[model samples]
Target: MIKAVFIDFYGTVVYEDGEVIQKVSQEIFVSGKVNDKSEIGSYWWNEFQTAFNNAYGDSFKAQRILEYKSLEKTIKHFKSSADAVKLSNLMFRHWIEPPIFEESKQFFELCPVPIYVLSNIDRADVLQAIKYHGLKPAGVFTSEDAKSYKPRKELFEFALNNVGLSAGEVLHIGDSLSSDIKGASSVGINAIWVNRNNREIPSGVTAVKNLIEIFDTKYFLHE
Candidate 1:
């Protein structure tokens, strides 16, 4: 029996910062000699992920700091004159005010189990977003709180301890395969993938196209 649900905040419960990232990337691309705008986006994401992967344990850095550092590298790589700090600030603002999905509101209203946010974002950003959207989750956990990001067991373990539930007692749902699915599974917790983009589902993994699909009797138990 599932006692609670652990859901991811950005890209899962609400819109991601893709638009703001695109806007920033476009500004950089326009200033730089890059031929393809997509290249800027790809490079920025790759840089951020590399930074994120390296951040853990004694080397832990807040997501905001990582974003700033990654943006600086991206700017330098493209030879763009844009200020990394300014662009990173824009991304932070968007993270704090991302639009909640309509179906998410419906899921919140109907989900029988208590829902807690288990995200890889900064604590303040996710908290502000929860307030901005008028959400009342059972609790919110973030990388800042655990001093480690997702795909690392520390964050998930921290969340489980706070929620007072064993790994098998809760279900974690999120959009990222590596972060949410792999992370949760690593700790013996069941997870559902919110594959909104119709990506190919891997074997033995359960998936849904949207939040509403979570209510399917096969995946969720009302009890």
Candidate 2:
């Protein structure tokens, strides 16, 4: 039986408004120069992934730092405004808090099991999000706490260890197919992907569309 639920933060509990950033960033920079916002987004994501992966072993780069570096690079590389650093600083301030999902708020209230947030965010920002949303989970764990990130079993193990529960006793739920589902499974935890975008349910992986679906008696309780 599952004793606790571990959920991801960003895409699961809260959703980031990327469009807001895109519009604002473009306004701050040269729109004529940065023709495709999606292109810049993809480039920023690639830089973040590279930094995150490189920091896995010993180096520890905070999410905010990565954001600054990525945004800085994107701005300069595109030959936008000369004030790239200033623009990114403005963006980073806005990036700290994300809007909480309505379904996630309801899940926190309705779920019978103890729930915790396990995310790959810096400690301060994670705590800020929790407070801003008024979330009262059993606990909050982040990359800052683990000194590593998701898609790595070590972080999953850290959450399991902190909860003092065996992998079998906990259920991990998140939006990422690779990080949440695979990482939790790597340590024997049952995981469900929160596929809100109607993605295909890959073989060997269980999924739910909304957070409430898992609580549906007819759908998941029988399992």
Candidate 3:
């Protein structure tokens, strides 16, 4: 008897075009003499993710800034730390502007359940994405608000507490097995991994190839 559903933002609901990689590459690593936009873009993207996670994990801007500066130096084929910061912000903005999946849009309209967004983004960006895509959900939760990140049960518990629902009554959906699935399960919530890469399903978690599959709520309800 699931009463609620929580979905992840970036890869789960929407995804950026591969052009985002080219943008970051030309701006950052390419100017610095790095080879291969795809490889460089992948490196910077990983660094960007690490910066945010370290920021949220430690619950302080100072440490995260320091971490970002360090990564800036590490990737210094092009510019200084200050410039790197600007490049990172630019890349981040592009990264969040994912094209909404048309099937997800229609599926959300017909799904007969409470829906929410849970992400490791700031409130402002979450709001921006929600509005930009005309998404309507019962609520939005972010790691910035939680003062921590997913894969840490406390963050999931915080969202659960806010919604006033027991873990059993809610379903958590996201793309990351380590974060979304493990974090949700730690709090006793059922999790579904939105496996975009056709990866093997980790043990003890349900999964789907796309958000549209969740329309068949019956399949998950019995799990």
TM-score of 1: 0.96
Q: What value does the lDDT take at residue 92 in candidate 1?
A: 93
Worst 10 residues of 1 by lDDT: 214-223
List the candidates ranked by lDDT, beginning with the highest.
1, 2, 3
TM-score for all models, in order of appearance = 0.96, 0.88, 0.80
CA displacement after TM-score superposition, residue 149 of candidate 1 (Å): 0.6
lDDT of 3 at 152: 72
**Cα lDDT, model 1, residue 12:** 96
lDDT of 2 by residue, 158-194 (tens): 8889999999889899999888888888899898889
Q: Write the per-residue lDDT of candidate 1 for residues 61-155, one digit (tens) a residue.
A: 99999989889988999999998888988989988899888799889888989999998889989999999988889899999888899999998
Q: Which structure is stronger by TM-score: 2 or 3?
A: 2
Alpha-carbon local distance difference test for all models: 0.90, 0.79, 0.71
Tens-digit lDDT track for model 3 on 44-82? 556656665666545534323543564575467445233
Residue 125 error for model 3, in Å? 0.7
